[model samples]
Target: MFATRRADLVLILVALIWGSSYLSAKTATAALPVLAVLFARYAISALACGALIGLRRRPRRWTRDEVRSGSVLGITQAVVLAVETYGVAHTSAANAGLIISLTIVLTPLLDRREGRRLPPAFFVAAGLCVLAVGLLTSSTGLHAPRLGDALMLAAAVIRAGHVALVGRLTVGRPVNPLHLTTVQTVVGTALFLPLATPHLPELAHSSATTWYQLVYLALFCSVFAFLAQTWAVQGTSASRASLLLGTEPIWAVAIGISLGGERLTVWTTLGAALMIAGTYWGQAVERAHRTSTPMEESLRSCRTARADGAARRPGAVVASSPARSSSRSRGDTT
Candidate 1:
């Protein structure tokens, strides 16, 4: 139980890092181009991850399999961040944060598509999330979603796909998380390098404040958060990890309203509440499913034992009756 609680705290810290990142990202992108901010973030993160790898006595190699797997995963991650960065730039950091919570709803659907069955409550939770998103996007009016909101929604879906891919790729493989993270960050940097080249020169001339924001994003949000989450998730259920990280949108809303100078409305509040509730409900269902698996297996074993015992009962009686009659006949002759 202590281990579970500790993992929960670690995961929540991951959420906090991500939650605070919306503001940081908003600030960085306000001054620099989206690609430039992303490039700087990943470049710093890659360096940090590499340094971490070096601290190990025998760092894992980047094997062919690792390269292939990491490249796919990294590119997917790059796309997720790119969309998110651009989306946050156009939208309020609060909106970006809350809307991205759609990832929690989308992930299980992806898992279901890959042959994992979910409970009915999961559908109910998903419906609530869908309703929440709809309410959030339409709060301005009963019109089309803003460009930023749409991009964020797209990012959420992509993020879900990224999560699903990780599960699939790592299922039976001995993939080193740190090595994979390093490769992913490096690849992410490479993906954004060209797009950010135009602003690279400006990076040197930028204010210390801008550089500080970049460093914070790289070190805390990307490097530390990623590593901590990876380690924590390995020690807990995926549902538990999702539940803890799902608080990100709440933090986003809180930070945005308090610090980012965003306004709150009734609809926004309602939507936020619904989104959080749905996320928690879905996670609960998943946890229940996980916890019940062993009981289900045990029940199956018990039924099998009962069936076998019943099948042998008549045979045992017949076999015993014949032996008893033989013993009686022998006693009479004696």
Candidate 2:
């Protein structure tokens, strides 16, 4: 239990690291094509990680099911990065940052349709409204990423599906998050490489700054951030995991304001605030729903059954009062 809390904290911190990638990616794309930049980022991270694994020589073996599951997970992440990279290249850094963060809202809807507990619908509606505001604030001067925005929206759906699938598939199973994450990086890179081929010549002229950006995305964002995210999600709730991740745009906004010299007008600020507020409320509702799950009700039910058994024991009769026991089981959702 104590360990889980610490892991959750690490997960939130990892989100911060991955969130800061916006600035790094935005800067790298100035001289590199989007696909090439992401290809370099994942390729570097995979090579480094593979070397570390080789050094440890850990015999990390998996069953066929694990490979299949991990591959599916990888494909989802790959699609998301591809779409998000394209979106970032075409849109303002702020808009890409905020729009990707909107995955928090999309995740629950996926979960609900898959038989996971659903949170309040208001939050979902509000999130779409906030996304519209983001579009408005970020679009202008023939610079609007109509295509890029569509791609980012696709990324959002892909990410949400990944979260939902992880939650449903890994329940009561022994799935290594690190292995799964590494596989996804491999898959994402595999998809990007073909697209990146045309830009290979550009790499020869790239400077040290580009390498630095690649290293950050590769090591911090790709490997460690993924390992941390996977570990945290197993112990934490999806909305809560995503809620902690909800801090991402905040980090992006900070990076933009400080390094990019970007300023937020009143509308952008208010829209972002509205988006954050809605997600928080959604998380609160989701937590309430989880705690009130049938599992908890079954716990109370088992307690009643135990007492009934005790009454049948020699001279051991519990009182027949029903009020207190009823109260114990009467959760809001129950």
Candidate 3:
């Protein structure tokens, strides 16, 4: 029980860290070019990851699959971050956070490994999310979405694809999460070096507060959040972990309002509530859909069979075979 509580707390903490990252990134980008900020964050993360790996009691060599998967994921992850950073630079942190939560629903749609069709209700929930986005992006009036909000929407889509790719590339493979993360940070550092070269001098002369934000983004948001989440999730169910982590947008809003002096108009307030409701509703629907039992599957099949037979004959009945009791397990990672 104590362990569970501790894990829950840790998960929430990780959520808080991630939630605050938009503001941190926004602050850092204000002081430096977006590319420079990205480069520094990745470089700092790479150094931290390297130091952590070196401090391990027994070092293990990276597996072939780990390196290959990490390289691919690293590039994709960089693209996601680059877009996300640029998005936040042009938008409010609260908006960025809220917009990015669209990933929660988008990921399941992108990743169809189970080959099970989500119930129609899931689509309704998704539609609610789309409505929420509309409200959020057009809080002032019914104009086009701000460039930042549109970029954030794009980031959410790309991040969903990246998450799906992570599942596809890492599932059933023996990949060390730490090693993979280290490789990813290293790869990101390499990818951004050339792009940020010209801005290196400006980045170096950034104020202490800007450097603090950069460090916070790299160390707390990336490394610490990832490690803590991985540890906490190991001590709890994926659903529980996801529930705790899903509070990220709430924290983002609270922090933005309290710390960043961001305001929410009536429309945006309604949009925030709708976004939260839509995401939780969608998450529950997806979880239930994913965890459907053998009996449920059998019943679905039986219904389809009955419909097909009914189409063929005036009155036809189709019976489902007895379902075998089978256990299904779910896993999650950051």
lDDT leader: 3
Residues 1-334, candidate 3: write the lDDT tens digits. 9999999999999999999999999888888999999999999999999999999999998899999999999999999999999999999999999999999999999999888788888889888888888888876776789999999999999999999999999999999999999999999999999999999999989999999999999999999999999999999999999999999999999999999999998878888899999999999999977877566888999988777877788676554344421222222221
- Cand. 2 TM to true fold: 0.78
Candidate with the greatest TM-score versus the true structure: 3
Query: Per-residue lDDT for 86-169 in model 1, tens only?
Result: 999988888889889888778877865335478888889988988887777766555678898899989999999999898887
The TM-score obtained by model 1 is: 0.85
* lDDT by residue (tens digit), candidate 2, 1-334: 8776886798778867876887788888887888889789878877876675677656577656566777787777777777788777765566566667656667767787436557456467555545554543553322344665666667777888888888776666777656666666677678778888899889767899898888888888888787778777888767567668778877777777788777766666766676666656665666666667778789989999999899889999687568867776685448
Better of 2 and 3 by lDDT: 3
TM-score of each: 0.85, 0.78, 0.89
Regions of candidate 1 where Cα sits further than 4 Å from its true position: 1-8, 233-241, 293-298, 305-334
Model 1 alpha-carbon miss at residue 225, Å: 0.7
Ten contiguous residues minimizing lDDT sum, candidate 3:
325-334
Q: Distance from true position, residue 325, model 1, in Å?
A: 34
What does candidate 1 score in Cα RMSD to the true structure?
8.2
lDDT of each: 0.85, 0.72, 0.92
Local error of candidate 1 at 189, Å? Answer: 1.3
- lDDT measured at residue 283 in model 3 versus the true structure, 0 to 100: 97
Q: Is candidate 1 or candidate 3 better by TM-score?
A: 3
